[model samples]
Target: MKFTTLLFPAVVLGAACPYGTYAPEEPTDTRGVCPMLNTLANHGYLPRNGRNINENQTVQALYDALNLTPDFGRFLFKAGRLSNPMPNATTFSLDDLNRHDLFEHDGSLSRQDAYFGQWSRFNQTVWNWTTQYYTSDLLDVQIVANSRAQRHTRSNLTNPMYSLSEVGYLFSVAENAAILSILGDKVTQTCPKKFADYLFTNEQLPFAVGWKKSALPITIQDLVTTFLAIQSATSFPPPPPDDSSVDIFN
Candidate 1:
């Protein structure tokens, strides 16, 4: 049954966004830890209510909005599904993804650590700290990677309950990779810093900044290539060897 999911087709190039428009406003609906996911819900790519999102909705939302391949989109949905507690659940609400450390992790570039008690809210000061490394209008792989590494290191040192498992670390790096691949030129491995700023702060796509979905579908391989680049460039101290706690939320 699961194999049939691979048959889902990618969105056609230049296709109109079927999810309506990218409208940013204060959300009264359930939201999640990931800014990009919340932005998708806000833009109506996912249900604005952010509830009961099925695999089809998730895959289509990703493909239509970000030009991601359906397979890659499905992989993300499956990962989020790990957070849902319902037995044999095939759907998930955005809030269900709030379960820590599935993909959401500590040392977020924008959100506060879970220990701070407002882990889900976007903190402007934290965002400012992360963006300080982006001195220019453009952000390259190394810049993004280093910024993430620095944030992780800081969190490890200051947050008394800090914890990041291998899974958390990988997801953190992948989040950066997603931003670079979706907003910047995949070949050049760079994107306009303003585009990222608008997305992270306002929870909106930076269409006004001349950002458009990639012409070529963003494959898993595209993300993998960027992920590897960021990972290789990142230089941060390892967590304590005895740090066995697995749960984390940013």
Candidate 2:
């Protein structure tokens, strides 16, 4: 039988966010850093791959870890930092990476996948101003994280492929921007077209028979083209001074 998973469809997306009081506090003081680390202590997620991070008091020591936002942390955790975020979105559930089938309930994603996955997750997932993991996806990211997940400064995603998660996140960002723009909201200037192209090409790129293809709901090109059109509308292209001054046949 052909096998395909209904991984993270809209129905699943509609599920209530499992977030509890985990509603992270504002990134003010680093006093409760240990508590954050403790959150993963019993899980042994730290000090792996020869980079030993003290599970107890290290997160707090990072007082200089500027821009330490909660969503950022969640991004890391899901992608395989703090922990492999959707470690097994491929196999089991997207709820918990640790519980994912990507690895043993015993741990995170497998090594081969981790190697590639982490590379993409760090560099691309966060949408850095310059660098990008051009043709990667979440599963691609999990490939690397499953292998070499750690708290090392270098381990931070530095891969050079584009990930679908990055594309999806960009779509969400664009959608949010479009909503704000409709309501006359101030929007940031960010061109994710390159990112969209990167992900699209990768999604449509051929893979070996044994490898998994991208998880897009449709063909890669169509999806990319559709989103590009949507996002392009959000770009701050100069409009004619007045609608009356515009021509429909331009």
Candidate 3:
């Protein structure tokens, strides 16, 4: 993917607290983090799935599933208020891990957090090639928008954060578009033709491609399916070059 070096404004971004603090009044038997972890495992993103669906997700488990480093967690704590630890802390305690439902199955995921993870992952890939991804600066901007201004913007475009449904839609629209833009046509053409066509046709209307409306809560299944689809489309190897032609000079 092509990397763009954009100037990031030096601004301190505040973090927002999780959705809610109170324990849920009603909990369902099937509601928990296991399904999400299972989906990731099935997709080869995780090693195995032994977690119970009814149990809350731990900080370490989340980081592991997302393939994020401890430094990234510290960055999130410092920038997004997603987590809080003692000053200069490297790991999360049990209290810090269980402090919010955002880390649990019962709590819904926010569009901001979802965008943060997606962008971070993409930026990491870019960083592997070049040191100009501007991930930290962009994350600071997102934190400011998500927490201080109550808005979520990416690539300088304003987007909403109603729920996980919105997150899915944004991922389908903005995130995919950003990837396509960064990778350019040459790289994107390597993906399955049908998948590329689907993305092109549904670029504007996410619901047409199975993304639910913004009001509905996106299930773990939906999130996993979306990620799997993206992985299948974007992570495939390119076709080998034709070697049938003989060299005239040789």
Candidate 4:
């Protein structure tokens, strides 16, 4: 699918604490992503050990710049990658799991019979806010008043001004993305061509797999911890019926 050229350096850029604290311990070395991204990874929104992006782009330049990254490796990997349970192929969502909705019929929304309706928006929020807060650092970074931040070191409270509901939503959104990817990978064969490339370039899953081959127990644990840490941080949509309003988010 040729994603390198279509890729953005979102993984490398840093995000600002619009409502919370913005004191990062150190700069994330990803050439493309920023500091916020680093926090997300460290906190588990993304796979712990992933790509190191640098720089960013917008407008047509964004497209042009994304096109410059390599996509072939990712595509090749996805086309043949197998699900852990022995599916013939990998799922497109390496991080998400409850993606059964990708093909299910929904009553409220069906812009058409042939199409499944709109693409998922969870990723959009992550991407949008990722771009949004980073470009325009605001002080409204909302970490819920009673959230874990309250228990964390004052210095470690990335942003402590948020109400609990606010932080819960953010935490929910991030956690959903990561878990859904993992779960989604479990159910499918032939990882989505587009996502495989994205993961290969952004999450550095390939590096983790290679580490496993060396048979170093510590490295294997490192790989798991990294992936787990990232997976543990972010979030994706809930399992269907996705009516989380009544179900409550974890």
- In the range 1-250, model 1's lDDT, one tens digit per residue, is 5654544442431143346576553457888788888899888889887888889999999998888899999999998677788989888988887777666789999998888788886899889989988877899998999889878888888999889989888889988998788767778888999999988888888888788888988888998899999989988766577645765552
- Candidate 1: worst 10 consecutive residues by lDDT? 8-17
Name the 10 consecutive residues with the lowest summed lDDT in model 4: 105-114
Clashes of 2: 35
Measured against the true structure, the TM-scores of the candidates, in listed sequence, are 0.85, 0.19, 0.20, 0.19
Mark the regions of model 1 whose C-alpha exceeds 4 Å error after superposition: 1-18, 25-27, 237-250
Off by over 4 Å in 3: 1-215, 235-237, 242-250
Candidate 1 has which clashing residue pairs, if any?
none
Supply the global lDDT for candidate 2.
0.27
| Count of clashes, each model | 0, 35, 1, 64
lDDT of every model, 2 decimals: 0.84, 0.27, 0.28, 0.26
The number of the candidate with the highest lDDT is 1
Query: Candidate 2, residues 154-221: lDDT per residue as tens digits?
Result: 22344233222443345333322321221111222122333223322232111222222223222223
As a whole number from 0 to 100, the lDDT of residue 229 in candidate 1 is 97
Q: Report the C-alpha lDDT of model 4 over 1-250, residue by residue, as the tens digit.
A: 5675445354334343221122322343221112223333333333334242212211111122122122322422232132122454332223221222222111101011112234221233324322332222211112111121222222123323312344333333332222222212322211232332233234322223321111111212222333343335433334566564784545
